[model samples]
Target: MPTTRSALMVAATAAMLAGCAKPPEAPPPSSSAYRVYVTNEASGDMSVIDSATMNVIATVPLGKRPRGIHASPDGKTIYVALSGSPIAGPGMDESTLPPPDKSADGIGVFDVKQNKLVRVIHSGSDPENFDISKDGKRLYVSNEDVAGVSVLDLEHEKVIATLQTGEEPEGVRISPDGRWVFVTSEDAGTIAVVDTAANKVVNSFKVGRRPRSIAFLPDSATAWVNAENDGTVVLVDAVKHTVVDTVQLGERGVVKPMAVLLSPDASTLYVSTGRGKKVFILDVATRKVQASIEVGQRPWGIALSPDGKTLYSANGPSNDISVVDLATRQVSQKVKLTGSPWGVITLEQ
Candidate 1:
């Protein structure tokens, strides 16, 4: 009888200890557990798409010509470039269009939680594209019309410095090391390297004809930039600001590379060919084109899923985004968007 009672008490004590023990921690969320945000240039609004459903859940109104979109380091805020300059296509007469509205030219600050534009930062004249600092305290913006790069202080909400770059500066990228910011000038076909510490243009080097966008490797030692008019991607030595090699995408005048993005592992390079209507996948080691998938007309902006299993391309003329599955090298779906989809980015929810 005593042995039986002691066993029961021991079992009870074990149960009590088990109940008091801490539970196991929940696993981290997968990459798809997020939302996709796209900027529509023609509609002047941002489309919020649920990543899982791949449907447009909300449309947040922004100012005129919202193009470049990027999220803060914490993914709590979004910054979009709002331009009032009339759309002047290549060779178009700017004198025929309406006068630029200076008031609408600024960077739209958006609150992710509020799902609205909280404020507008007066970055500079004709703010087209920009890249935020690693600390999210500063923004390096490219003023296309002004032909300069403006360094804006997020804390003060003002432009601290504006350094003259090449003509028609459009693409702005900060190196992975956070030491230099690179701006691409389409007309000049050159890249202007800015020293982040000094906020000055330290070097300018020609890459190709009409360099459009740039993507840097994880180590920040190498960079890949697209030369639109040349129909090629130039491999650049990030440290020296010099071109090491050029990989011809296609015949000039037919294939115009617009945006370049590196894989998470930096093993593959993706190039979105504007007007070429296709996205080319290339092996970085061999610098050889592995495959090409026809996405849509004028695919300008490209982004990869967090897991690196999927790719999304913003088709400006088609008004849709191509969702590609990297494993099969095929487009799995096309998410339609209102107006011309100019830029695309994914953020964790």
Candidate 2:
């Protein structure tokens, strides 16, 4: 009798489940959802490109010299570095140029869904570039003119701490573990490794002449610094806080490296040579340049998709974005951007 009751209960439960409404299937990804955002530094604006159509849909005016772009880890917001510091060349005298409009320095925050500039937030004077924490609670900003990095609290939009750095700090990168931040001092030619918890420069080491940009591995075990003037990529051991090796990008005075990008798996690296007009493919284990893909002239910033299928480079001199097919290692398209493109970031829906 007990077995019969158990069978009856099972039958009743199955009948109830069968009569219940079925769950709906998830929809496929929309083709037009992918987008590429390019910052035009010289134009003081940013252009939004629709990747599906390969056409620029809109250009939003930002403050003076919009550069160094990065999206929040959640992909809901984008932050761009904006500055009004007088633009002076290498040989130009700073005194002759107009004083940096400290008032014009700020970080522009944009809403992804709204497709509009939400507000302009100021962290410190001349926020040239910055890196947001994984939790999106903080931002480490490299103040180009001030020779330090301003750590800003995201919720309040105010600088919480200032970490001293070398002269003319330009590039700021945070480790995956969030324990350290590596800042490149352009004029000082050194990397200032900061311990975020202590909010101070923990270690400093010479990389090469004019280290402008840097990229780190997923494990935070190694980092690569772009030695622009020397035309080489100096590899650094993050754990040891030392320069492990140096890999030459191109000939002297010809291949000025502007940026370094690591693959999703950290097995390969891609370097954008500024004057070389090409992106070099590197094998991680061997640390050798396997091949070079010719991109537009003066490629400055580089970004890769989540799937690592497509690569985008902001070509400054040519005023365009070179879309490269990583599988084929060839230029698939050149999307024209009217202004001088400085930095680029892409999001795939």
Candidate 3:
């Protein structure tokens, strides 16, 4: 009944409208083969590797500064902390740096099976790191610039609360019992402990200079925090929230601890020494360094193998992953990558 020109115009308008419509909720990740996901901060991409073959499978492009990464309980999805903040350190003037890209500041959720980023949830501002609750319903994210912890409701995709923390919060972890959450403040040189049940900062204690990373034992009764500037790893009593012991990794300027991981049997703690070009293996009970293996240049993010036989570390400067054999306590292989890998996490079959 209408002219063809008018009908085509209407069809074009409808198509445009549909394109502008909001996207629907994404489905959960499906079952996939076991693989290791490495976040490359400099390249803004994630490198997927075949664990069995120790070969890189694919490179998934993400947003800027994909630093912290964690796998969901079911291993169906992986969350990445993508920030827009300008990187600053002890002596740098932050005012001279460019403004943060607000649009890129969010938590990127990658579907395991699809091997792609399906959603990006707002995480307040400059979420450098985060820890998910045991039930996978909440995220305690560290907002570096604002010095606050943003608690977001995972299912609803909304922030329910914001808890104050020390200046420049970075490292974040949840207790195994799910009773407490710990965030390390680099500038404050302290650990802010949040009582999840009360939804408040229950305690705060200084460990040493520049606490960057943390790891908990299997029982979660104790925690190890790496004091970067001090080049030491301090043990903390989780329940009491107090420093119990300290194990020095290397000389102050030579050995900077960036990441720590616990053995499955809880007998040892593997530490990645930034700029030290090595990973320190410490005996847990004795609190002493048993051995140190040369990895690569500035090994930052580290992860344990499923079978507890090998260790993987993301070496930033070298742009590769150092694979260490636990039994041999040495680096067995180095998987080459093109980007500056910052964080590493593994998903199993």
Candidate 4:
């Protein structure tokens, strides 16, 4: 037996040693159930997919030329952009306008719980793409033909304001903090950063030719803009509001690129080549093309699952969505849909 002082010292040392030891290890990651929604522009319908089973659960009819799509933050509602007059945009002859389609030029609000379109809120002329604010109270709709961004009040279900932007704006994305909205001008080859609170274009930066879509990195410190005309992806620094670098994807003679999506981990970026029929997987840190997987004819719209394990590419001419497994970087499944698929969104329970 040790003396009282010696025993106390031993106990103190043991306590300190125990406190310095590492904690037990954490469990490995696992998969979770997810749902994928694809908007078929040709079919005028939406395809619902069970991500776990990789099967189509149901197909719901939507408005004409349904292109841009987004799910509510709480996953309660899915807003689909509907263009009644498909040929209303710039450079189009007014005489060519198809008989007015009542369902066009508005947002089809689908109640996710009910699995149906609950309401149609008129946004403006030719709503192409849209983004929801961080607080989920407002929606920014990029009306391509109208050359402006329409601010929709979700609670009021009405357009509160419309701010003029560049001609033929195609992509609209809200900043991570929901303070700014970035809209891409396909015809102008520029990006207009709008101040959400002020409802005005605050900054405009020149990017690659025909900038169509935009995606931000995980940190939101930088964003990437896909330039279809130049076949390059321009990286924009968020704080400085400038193009830091440009990554060329394909030769000008090859094909035009359409959409850009960043992996959930921010490790890789996926770009769909509209005329190339190939999806390019790029390493974010290295900015190198890691793999170029052949998808389908006229692959335009692209999306990734919430967990970042799967990728969905909408091939317009093929009229199907190619499901790519991120881990293996292979085409796991091809989900056939009605007409030309344009936009995709993933939902999780």
Candidate 5:
């Protein structure tokens, strides 16, 4: 019974309302694919490589000396360690040294979506390596010079606690359950196990000379500490907090093992020998070297893909990443970077 104009207006309004209705929901993310991020220390840049393509898709510029790199558990952000320390020693004192021309020596936060460095969170002095809590609420950063761990609250983006550790803490890792943090002391040759809830060092155990890197098995029952100077990997039982076994990788004075990585299934362990220029694959059950692949010179960091089909080693002197196919057990590809690539991390989207 409405007039013609009124009828037309009503129809137009109904049509507009229909158009404003929500569209169909977006499909979920592809579960099969992922990305890999590698930090180049000398180049001051990071390389973003597509897992499927094995090609460098983007290069993100970060602060000077971007070394230790880690991806958030959600795969939403990448944290890189930017050291402002002097090339010779820990440069002049922070107060006396000239202010940084750009970003300071801290954690460079990169938003994965934008592929850019979004912020630099000031950690303690000489933030070398770091680890995030299992719940993703806290970040434990190892300040090498300060000889402690700076616990950063992710939600607040500030350092809330600094727990004193051994001398020259180089590698820091949180347990899978998020209850304990293990820090390796390069100069002290010890590992400090921190109880997260209590925020205290529960125990400190002796390791080999210069414990530079640490890795835990998937079950979280055992951990492997790499002694760079001793050329050995010490296996520690987490519960007992004791060294259960020590597997010698290279000769007493020949090889230098820098980083340790476990396979996705936790059946194999991989160690990068710096002076040997080889990646040693060890069978976890037997604690013996199963294979050794000659990689580039001075491989400092190593990471395995999600599927455990590929291994990536960052060769410092070669300034390239050696991609080894797990099945073939050889270098499949070497991706060149701008500078010395040290920290390599794989991301599954």
Candidate 6:
């Protein structure tokens, strides 16, 4: 009934409104294949590798310094810690590096099905590592530059708390029972225990020099922390939050333990030595060295396969992933990646 000119104007306005509206989210997948994700810190992208074929399937662009990577409890989403801080390795001069772009620091939320970054949650300053709650509502993130831990509420997408910690906090992990949140302070050489319910640090104890990573048993009775400078892994009494023992992997200064991962059965402990260029296998029951597999240069992040038959190490310097076959305790394949790979995680969907 309207004139052609008026009808065209209305149609154009409607189209503009439609373009401004938010796009609908991709529907959840009914089925998915197993894939390994690696975060490249230098190039600011994530590599998706097909587990069945042992080949890289896709590369998703993330942001600056994507270091820590973890999946949601439901395996629907992956959260990566992205930082704008300039890279300063051991013995490197920090003063020479450029200033940090504070705006680029946040936790990247990637939708597994879409293989894309859905959003970025504010995670305080310089988030290096983080762990999710059992129900997956909250994220305990280590604010490395601020020397504190930020508690981010996923539903509200806001930081609920910023708890204090020692200097240069890096590794973050929650106990299996979900009663405690553990954060490692690298420069302080200590672990801060946060009571989840109380939402505060209840205890802080020294493990050893330069502790960076933590692994817990299934029962949550004990935990193992890497003492990087000491070239040893320290066993902790998870309940008492006390150190029980230390297992030497190699000579100090050479064998710097970076990441600790436990087998599904909790029978074996796998440790990636940063500069040592090896993954040390230890017998959990006896706390003895079982074997040391040479992986690559600066193997920092390690993950066990879903079936528990293979291990993947993110070698930062080599810019590749070393696939270790657990049965042979040897490196079976090396998957090349662009940029410096910092963290690796496997998801079977």
Q: Ranking under lDDT, best-scoring first?
A: 6, 1, 3, 2, 5, 4
Better TM-score candidate (2, 5): 2
TM-scores of the models, in the given order?
0.90, 0.89, 0.89, 0.86, 0.86, 0.90
lDDT of 5 at 52: 72
**Tens-digit lDDT track of model 6 for 256-323:** 99999999899999999988999999999999999999999899999988988999999988899999
What local lDDT does model 6 show for residue 177? 95
Estimate, for each residue in 252-322, the C-alpha lDDT of model 5 and write its tens digit: 65788889888877889999998789999999999999989999988988998888899999998888899
Write model 3 residue lDDT over 1-349, tens digit each, in one string.
Answer: 8799999999999999998796877753433456889999888989988876777878998898899999888889899999987766567998899999989999999998788999999998999889998889999999988999999899999988899999989999998899889999999899999999889998899999989888888788899999999999999998888999988888998999988888888888999998898899999999999999999999999998777788999999889999998888878899998678999988886
lDDT agreement of model 2 with the native: 0.89
Model 3 TM-score (2 dp): 0.89
Summarize candidate 1's per-residue lDDT along 127-171 as a digit string, tens digits. 999999999999999999989999999999999999999999999
Shift in Å, residue 52, candidate 6 = 1.1
Cα error of candidate 6 at position 261, Å: 0.4
Best by lDDT: 6
lDDT value, candidate 6, whole model: 0.94
lDDT of 3: 0.90
Predicted candidate 2: what Cα RMSD to the true structure? Answer: 9.5
Off by over 4 Å in 5: 1-32, 88-103
3 or 5, greater by lDDT:
3
The alpha-carbon lDDT assigned to residue 157 of candidate 5 equals 88
Which residue runs does candidate 3 get wrong by more than 4 Å?
1-33
Candidate 5 local lDDT, residue 307: 81
